[model samples]
Target: METFSIHPIGYVRERDGSKVLEVLPEYRPALDKLDEWGHVVSVWWFSGSDNPDTRSILRQTRPHQSSPGEAGTFATRSPRRPNPLGLTVAKIDRVDVEQGLVVIDRHDALPDTPLLDIKPYSPGSDRVEAPILPEWAAHWPKSREESAVFDWAKEDGKA
Candidate 1:
């Protein structure tokens, strides 16, 4: 097996007054030019799910009951996987270089989550005009604004 090394550049400080990505003092200068972008794609570790059992799970029944049948780890976005990683595109509310903070409008990552990388979100490369999706998830929110009000529990067959 091949081995690799990775380190976190920062941590998500969710309870320190407000949720924000706080870069390490040494890496603070790295956030020098990230303000021009309206949004950022954050890559972070799913530390909560990084364990032997979760990493060993290669297949399982779908979490959302609405989605039928079993699925391989790669086919689903479940936290339990060989590598517990999370990617989220968050709206950049503000960037304080002095504080090494990048305040985002929203992020699902928990407090102290390790940030792997941050990239400016580019619509040209990230957006798809017409993409295909499973029939069960075809009715999902079309935009972030819509997602705020979308009934997730209902879609997941919990309601």
Candidate 2:
């Protein structure tokens, strides 16, 4: 077996202010020019996951927040898996060099998520064709224009 090691460039400070991550010192150098970008893609490890005693008996149902469905850990975004890794794209709301951290507008990741890698979300550099998704997954629930309408209706309660 081969062993590997990694360090974090920076950590994600959630908008709510209840969560924080201490990025590894070794990888701190990578943050030199990171904050200039408006948004970034974060690849992290679910370090705080409540790992199940038996991997074979992991849950296959979706959380209460989503529609009921059965899926393997790989099929759904379940953290309790062989490798508890997660990826999220978040807007860079603020950066604090002195504090050694950056704030993201939105993050579903739990506290203590080990920051693995960070990449700028530049359209010219990261753009790609639509990814192949599972049949059950819906590609972007609404369009940008439709989202505006939905947002307005949600606030007005006129939907």
How well does each candidate superpose onto the true structure, as a TM-score?
0.91, 0.64
Would you give me the overall lDDT of model 1?
A: 0.84
lDDT of candidate 2 over 1-159, digit per residue (tens): 576776655555554664443455666566677779888778887777646542343565653233345556666566667667788777777656556566766565776666878778877766556656444444333333344334332322112
Cα deviation in Å at residue 35, candidate 2? Answer: 2.1
- What tens-digit string does per-residue lDDT give for candidate 1 at 1-159? 897798999988774456698888888888888999999988999999999999999986765666767768787778889989998888888899888899988787898899999889999999888888788778888877798788777755234
Which regions of candidate 2 deviate over 4 angstroms?
A: 7-11, 14-26, 50-59, 62-69, 124-127, 139-159
- Among the numbered candidates, top TM-score falls to 1
TM-score of 1: 0.91
For candidate 2, give the lDDT of residue 1. Answer: 59
For each candidate, the alpha-carbon lDDT, in order, equals 0.84, 0.60
Superposed Cα deviation of residue 116, candidate 1 (Å): 0.6
Clashing residue pairs, backbone N/CA/C < 3 A, model 1:
none
